[model samples]
Target chain A: MMVSQRPSEVSTSAHERVYRTLRSRIMYGEIAPGQALTLRGIGREFEVSMTPARESVRRLVAEGALFLSSSGRVSTPELSNERIEELAALRALIEVELASRALPRAHMALIDRLQGINMTVAEMISKRDAVGYIRANLEFHRALYLRAQAPAMLAMAETVWLQMGPTMRALYGRLRRTEPPRNHKLIIAALKAGDEPGLRLAVRSDVTQGLRMLAG
Target chain B: MMVSQRPSEVSTSAHERVYRTLRSRIMYGEIAPGQALTLRGIGREFEVSMTPARESVRRLVAEGALFLSSSGRVSTPELSNERIEELAALRALIEVELASRALPRAHMALIDRLQGINMTVAEMISKRDAVGYIRANLEFHRALYLRAQAPAMLAMAETVWLQMGPTMRALYGRLRRTEPPRNHKLIIAALKAGDEPGLRLAVRSDVTQGLRMLAG
Candidate 1:
């Protein structure tokens, strides 16, 4: 007998399945910066043909989540300090606006949801799981931003996040922090208080602070 | 004997050539919003096989320059009013920052080049050439932003431009202006006076003023 599958899983196309899974892995810092990927290897790993594999890579490359070299090699980007700073600034610009838009709509349930995600972020930190930490942290921010009803802005912010993922992994190794980011608490408090400027500042600081150290 | 070709043209891959040409067409509003494109049609037009055409389409879709429906139709996006506003806000945020960053680096030569581009923009507007006007307008903004030395930020800004391309064509038709945007002159004045805040305001106004009306 066939095993039951989730409705979403059942509806996903093979190429889309491969694309979503690979995109998450890269975006969560499961892949290291400058790591190379081969179409043959990806096809074998995902149990798909080269066409789907190539399409996924092309999509990721277009999103700036992957880099394609002149020699026809595909790899995660190894961003320079300047590039890192620019991406971080973009995150600050976009995410701060997202947070500000989300402020008036930030109900008790959303704040609670953010708090719950923050706990997961702390748990990942304590467990020393860098990828999990990054994923949870993003979830926390995304949960807040979702209330903004600004899909285009959120997408832009996520693209910046995807571009920074590998570098964030590298930074996680260098950081070795025992606590979660303090800015998350500030963000939550600002949201609860309905403080737009505070929320914007907190969001900007939360997004840019860590990356600034790396850029420096 | 084979006709002479440009070195850049000779070096471009089949897919890259197709991708670049198609990207420009879409970005310049040569295509209407909600216009459908078939792979077979694209392949015939470009004299290429299905693979390169598919690749180019996939890349554009990922960049938000095109949309892919669940039924497997590919078309230029017909953006909603809300989406248009969000994208305009994004342009204001990023382009203003880019202009501010580029200010100190804007030499007299660059200002002259910008004026020359503004002339072309006016010429296109007077001729009622929507595509040419869009292309020249982008060139003027891009020439200024290139001095920012922030590729990642610029790429994000360009993606927003790509998404707005078709909508911009519609706006151009509605506008039917006899004069260029007044904000362009303000931008030039601010740059000449080395006024940072003035430069930011001008850039933000220039990018968002036209689109705000469409969204409204």
Candidate 2:
């Protein structure tokens, strides 16, 4: 007998596939702030039906990664300066705690992994790949925070990052930096020394400094 | 002339109505942890169609207010001890900051209103109304945090609260507390005195103390 796939199973996978791909696009800043999208367009891009596309959009909207207007228009959010500051503060608060928790558990291998990710981050900077840079930078942080054994906190931190992704892409264009963030080096050093306070400071600065400038 | 509503508009409102009502039910602990829900049941309860019910469930799942199983079952989450502790720490982190920020803006009117809410909290405790207790307790915190002018931070705080809601209801049954939380009085006093440090400590204590006892 041939294996039977139910319609719900098919739709579930399609919806999840579309949701994850679109989530990364917004989370990595591949989509710019205020960029509009339609369900039809998303369906066409993902080669999925409208139901899956609509579900994906609804999920992203719930996470604050995408905005759905009263008129049923969907777009990336253009955050106000105050909103940016609030999110930056949230990032600072949550990420700093994550780094602090990770400090005790951060082994040599994890630090080395972070440093390797940092190298990729620098290369992305040199190549002027905003999306690549953002992705690698988050990889570095996530690498450290994974050791914290605090999935809920890490999830909260990622939500903040997702919300800031589009605006961060906008900031990347403005900064035009030749090097990766200096705070990454500080973070690596603090991790090596197992300095909790230093790690907290480095993480707070790394997460908020660029965003504060953008907010200003 | 008859006014015609678009299909999308009709579905949107129906979905929103279902979502908000269910969200409050979860947030106020009217629903217990590990409580299973079905789309057909939700649709019948809300008197809406399957589409809106599914959409509402999806949104709540995204918000961490509900959990969706791999096989497509939906329920309120049954958080582990570690998850509970992490969420408690997050509540301490974000709510303390919110309270500190609101202190400068915590005028007499706001303090009076908070005291009023506190009274209701006591009444709920005496009545042994778990959901009412959680609702009025959150009303106290939310009223204070609203003056912080930090919607993102407040939203983050509320997400933590939502995650803890069912657990808090369980804790309520276990503790059999006959009075309002003592830390709340400290918070009110700190607000009246404009003591930032005191306010932060009070908020931290208020948010974490009960949860820690439960986790222990």
Candidate 3:
């Protein structure tokens, strides 16, 4: 999720800094699932004490972005198939509402911006840059949801994205697609036409189509 | 807001136990908004050390159920009107989908159980017991959403509840009503008729109406 702050290595508290850095990496699918992590390793990598590393790990665990064992071992989550399906359904239900809400506010400038982002997504696909593709795809949706003028709803939707991150990386890695995101085109067209229902359908279709590949 | 576990007073680690208890109380609206909390006070209340108390507070803060000031003081959240509206919209979006998914699985016995819970909600309202009413009303929603077999969706809906708990307590306390939950009856009727659209509308109305009272 956005977590409301950029990671500043300069002045924030150690744990807060670690929390933001780890949160962003997880939300953007930089981490792989089931990868074991230790407080010592995190402390070493971030050049912080173990206390802050442990606290940051605890914070991420609270956000459902990471898993912690009873013995205090921590790892990126390996979501079950059932959990994956539910998150996909949630994305469909919420993003459709967000896109519909944004429809009245979407102007040509916004549409042009989305098209630019879509091009970056296409570039990522061609370059086989998984993280870049994930970042650009989220940027496209974030740009849309921002117009909804609903921060709470946007934050919740982004949390679902955070939870889906590692698994999405796996899903995308397994299914290589040559085509650009056709559903994004539909989203842009619906916006241009100010079609609320069409926008909802396009958003839902885009979310579900990508997810169904994992399910199948 | 169930957090899928009961608050255990024994055997578990002190922090885990404290987290579960505080989570349940906050989720159930047992705490009031703007209620200032200190780590020292929590340690005393739960008869635990400051370490566990601090850890639990950190977890709740991470979950958005509690707010922490820059000075590190903690308090139950007092939501703004706009935030409340967004959460209500979220509820309508997610719960309607959950109810629709549950419809085919909602047997007569399930419907009967909901009727029983609704009766308890009515009783609590009549008794002018705000917390009891909130708990029963949530139980009513929970019992129905449980049948959806969508754990992740249910968990998301419950987090909205957790975030709203204090505000909901404050809202219901101000608006005393003589009638039972009328929209709930419509929900039951729609469920019985197997009308998906009716069910969605009923659920949406039920979710929106209670929240609108606070909005007004």
Candidate 4:
């Protein structure tokens, strides 16, 4: 809080700054599930006034990226096992659609791009860097969804990623087998085959496997 | 402007009052897409300060319910034909998944409840009440999504609806035809039969019909 109080931090429009900063933190898993954030604390950290911070929090809450308690404590959502599965179900629901649309738009260049990113993902896993792993993997998916050209659907998928971030971090840390599975290769195969149903299955498997492993 | 000056208006939270009032106008299609909204106009209309009005605008803009111009003039979003199709595509993606999950959980009582709502939809169409018709139709779909128990997916679907609200009003007004077609009836049947592919097709039909009408 003390370090965040510098006058130079006060310049940008408060709400956008807060939204971007907090969204990045949540997306990168710097926040943990059920960890509380207050309007004052956020204001202090961002060096903005409380009103802007409150507005930012409310919008994030509306997006389901952050949960607001009945008494109004804002925090990352803590998922039940069932809730986790339901979100995974949502990722499968949206991503497979994106992936299929993306395939026609994805030429060999795009496949090579995903493969390049997957190498970094593998490195992140080996290094036990949860943030890097999450970021790199989502980059691969987002790159694919970009080709779908459905910004609204992609944004929706990103919202799911935002909500699941903290829980994902906790899950990954526990299940750290020192590597991401070889699923990316399978995903690429389904993509290469232009097998819509097969691609769908692969996406579903990738989305659900982590949850199933944790629960099992 | 004079009304705002009258201090006798019951005091409400200025920001919320502004938000609700603006959102109502936009959602009700009193404000058309791509129409610029000035902060001063909103503040003057709601009898609040500019800051509160600005905050409301920013929040709605973030919800994707409103768009902010480069000059920061806010307005309801104007979607292209392709964009509308994209939204329809999203509805297909998310709602089909929702319908599938919702199938086993949708029993006689839920079906009865939907049937009951469909009757009101019939009334709204007969009365040519566009708002009531749209609201009731969304209610019917939302009730079904609840059985899927996928909050994230439902939220995404709602965002799509929110963006489409004004255009929906435009379409409903132009179409002015009663009856949601035989497909709504088919959907209930598919639900009753617990048929996954049937349910998916029924949902696709129900979801696609509106956009098809709009396009035509």
Each candidate's DockQ score against the native complex?
0.88, 0.89, 0.70, 0.53
Q: Who is ahead in DockQ, 1 or 2? A: 2
Query: In candidate 3, which residue ranges exceed 4 Å CA deviation?
Result: A1-10, B1-10
TM-score of each: 0.95, 0.94, 0.92, 0.87
Q: What lDDT is reached at residue A166 by model 2? A: 96
In each prediction, how many residue pairs overlap at the backbone (N, C-alpha, C within less than 3 A)? 0, 0, 0, 0
Q: Which model, 1 or 4, shows the larger DockQ?
A: 1
**lDDT of residue A7 for candidate 2:** 62
Report the C-alpha lDDT of model 3 over A106-216, residue by residue, as the tens digit. 998999999999999999988888888888999999999999999889988988998888888888777777788899999999999988888888999998886678757
Cα lDDT tens digits, model 1, B1-216, are 433434456677778989999898899898999999999999899877888899999999999999999988999999998999999999999999999999999999999999999999999889988889999999999999999999998999999999999999988877755787578889999999999999999998899887666745
Task: State model 3's lDDT.
Answer: 0.88
lDDT of 3 by residue, B66-101 (tens): 999877789999898888889999999999999999
> In candidate 1, residue B212 scores what lDDT?
63
TM-score of 3: 0.92
Worst 10 residues of 3 chain A by lDDT: A1-10
Worst lDDT run of 10 residues, candidate 3 chain B, spans B1-10
lDDT of 4 by residue, A1-216 (tens): 453555765566567789988987887777788889999999899767887798788878866778877666898899888778878878887888888889888788889998899899999999998888888988988988899988877887898898888888888777648756577878888788877788878888888888887777
Q: Which stretches of candidate 2 lie over 4 Å from their true place?
A: A1-12, B1-12
Q: What lDDT does each candidate get? A: 0.90, 0.89, 0.88, 0.81
Number of the top TM-score candidate:
1
First chain TM-score in every candidate?
0.93, 0.92, 0.92, 0.91
Top candidate (lDDT):
1
